[model samples]
Target: MGTEVQCTLCPTECELENHQVGGCKVRINRDGTLYSLVYGKPCAVQVDPIEKKPFYHVLPGAKAFSIATVGCVLGCKFCQNWQISQALPEESEHRDLDPDEVVRGALYYGCQTVTYTYTEPTVFYEYMYDTALLVRKFGLLNSVHTCGYINQEPLRELAPLLNAADVDLKAFTEDFYGRICGGRLKPVLEAIVTLREMGVWLEITNLVIPTLNDDPKEIRDMCRWLVENAGPDTPIHFSRFFPYYKLKNLPPTPIETLNMAQQTAREAGLRYAYIGNIRQSGENTYCPSCGKLLIERIGYFVKQNLLQEGACPYCKSSIAGVWDQT
Candidate 1:
């Protein structure tokens, strides 16, 4: 049982008894002490653009030190990074970086933020939480890219260190979540709502796989739910899905599907919807008020920025997102 200690990290409030692991396979219960085994031991680390995290809203055009550890709570059939996402701590190699060392490394690399990414950061909850706290102490912000499978108690406990989050709503239907992902949909939705309520800058990513979770009606429904819960101005990235890992028989998501998804979200009242992983000019940011090109991006690199102190330079309308240039 995950009941020996309190664990509401990401919807999986796996209370541990003595000498057991939670559903995520990283957190451990050792003789009544619940310890996150992956703490201070990052299995992976890299430096990347902030937009690569697909967080176009948080500190755009900045560098973020991205890190992750092995293990994941949800067992999705089509996981792109299953080698690490499904591997145990021993199964994957790790760097000898501690939480404090992580902060120092980000600073050394000229990164403005530390991102808990690559794999499910929630599975490595202890590592991410400790590192986030230490990273924030150095004045660098902490962000997370997660599937939003967290419990309320643990999320609140870690909120002080959390700044921004890119949570995947995954799919709208519980059937997709249960039959395909071996998880429930309610908790993911709850985590999104909780993150918003906790004042975390929230962005959403929905991977539209062909014949799986790509029903246009369902996508529209999901967008409506986001607009209702996360607000219309919230940025939602309709990511392109490729045939990878276990779902290789299917071809990559068509560009047209991505465009349609974007239009669907915008029609549903999401003002900042985007189509990701495609090198289209439409990827550039436009002023929501005046349709002026605000920030131009080519792939992950920023080409031109027209924001004057966080407001659109053309219309002077207040844009959403944090861009303090710190």
Candidate 2:
């Protein structure tokens, strides 16, 4: 009988037989040993503004050296990076950059942090883990923009090394997760709470798709849950969803919907809520206590930051975020 290995990294718990790849399309079991096919092989690499990660609460106006491999655990229908996220390891061209090299690239580019983004970082767990260790040693921070689909054990192990995270909360309902994302909602929610408990500076992104998850009640419920579990200080970004990938049948999210979602987050006791993907007053950060503009941002660029040592200069209200690399 051939031996099999179970990948417990994510909730999917894909058990694979010899020579079979797991559901993530990156991990394969060979002779009872499981190996990551995408480790040290990232298909997407670049330097982006930290705001581009939609991380408003972490080192505002800093640059992040971003990297990602070519596979994901959950298949989201409206994935913006589907070209790389849904492709197999062998299907895309990748750079052979090891952990040390990744740290070197970050230093070379003058980045304050190394971000695992553009695709689900959980899919390249080993690579991200190793690089995160080196990133810390080199006096740089580690961040990830993930879908929050990871299991508890792996998330706990990785949390200490992670300085910040932006979890894509997709939607509030299990029906939406199962139908639109081909995954479950419970684990994602659990991961978010776990990230908060682990002392990681956490932000959330909810891509509001029209007619799918734009229901006001559902949005309110999600914001309330986030406030209750992840704390009222956690920043949430209500991003406008554009039709793409397998979800092209749907139109872009209405501007009013994004605004309403942000308003709901605030009403739910979330201190910092912002609208993303479109230019508006929501792109800037204001003091939750005094409502004074703390950071003025134009798209991904920070025009001015009036924070004095992570506090609102106007009202002296301390903001919630990793303001400095130290």
Candidate 3:
């Protein structure tokens, strides 16, 4: 009893004995106290375009100072960043960047947004929470790219400091999540709803893997649910999946499948559905009412943004996004 603690950050509810790490391999129990081992330690750090986070609606083309530590809550067989996400935090190379240093790095790199990405930010919750607070002092916005496999309390606590988020929907069925992701679907869905309730700008990313979760009907159901629960304007990115990690036996997701998902989303009342991983017209943001081009993107780079003060120039339709940081 003196040397055991439970991690309530996520649905996993990992209970650990003294010196034992949780499922995330980041949070550890030490003498009846929980400690985050990856706090102030980042394995990856860089300046990336905000679009790379697939947050098309938030600060388009703005540079984001991105950082991530190793370890993830889910065991996605096809995780692109499994090299880090699957490893123990100390097993990877990391930098000694504290909250203040993280803020300074973003400012030094001319990035107005700080993104906790490349791996699940929830695993490193303490670090991200502290960094978000420090970054706010200097007028920098904070964003998270996550799996959304977190409990409501921690997510609610973190929401006030967050400006935007991109949650990976992964798939629509509990079976797919259990078999392919080693997780549950319901918690992720709840996380999405909670983020929206907190008034956080939310976007979704669904990687359409061939024959796995690429069924058009399921995609439509997911879209319809978003439209009903999260709203029609929630931007959804249908990302193309490439073979990686344990799922390399499967071929990459076909272009046609991504197109089908995108079409399904629009038809299901989603106003801003996009295709990713392949370059084409789906990358651009068009006005839902006027069908006029609002933000033209060419493979993660903004070609032209025609929005005049966050409204469509032709019809003056209000675009839903965080256009201004101030």
User: In model 1, what is the error at residue 293, expressed in angstroms?
Assistant: 0.9
Expressed as tens digits, the lDDT of each residue in 62-106 for candidate 1 is 999999888888988878778888888866688888988898889
Residue 59 in candidate 1 has what lDDT?
83
Q: How accurate is candidate 3 locally (lDDT)?
A: 0.94
Candidate 1's TM-score reads: 0.94
CA lDDT, every model vs. true structure: 0.85, 0.93, 0.94
Candidate 1 has its poorest 10 consecutive residues by lDDT at 1-10
Model 2 residue runs over 4 Å out of place are none
The TM-score values for the models, in the order shown, are 0.94, 0.99, 0.99
**lDDT (10s digit) by residue, model 2, range 193-265:** 9999989999999999999999999989998999889999999999988889998899888898888998888
Q: Model 3, stretches more than 4 Å misplaced?
A: none
Give every collision pair in model 2: none
For model 3 the local lDDT of residue 81 reads: 94
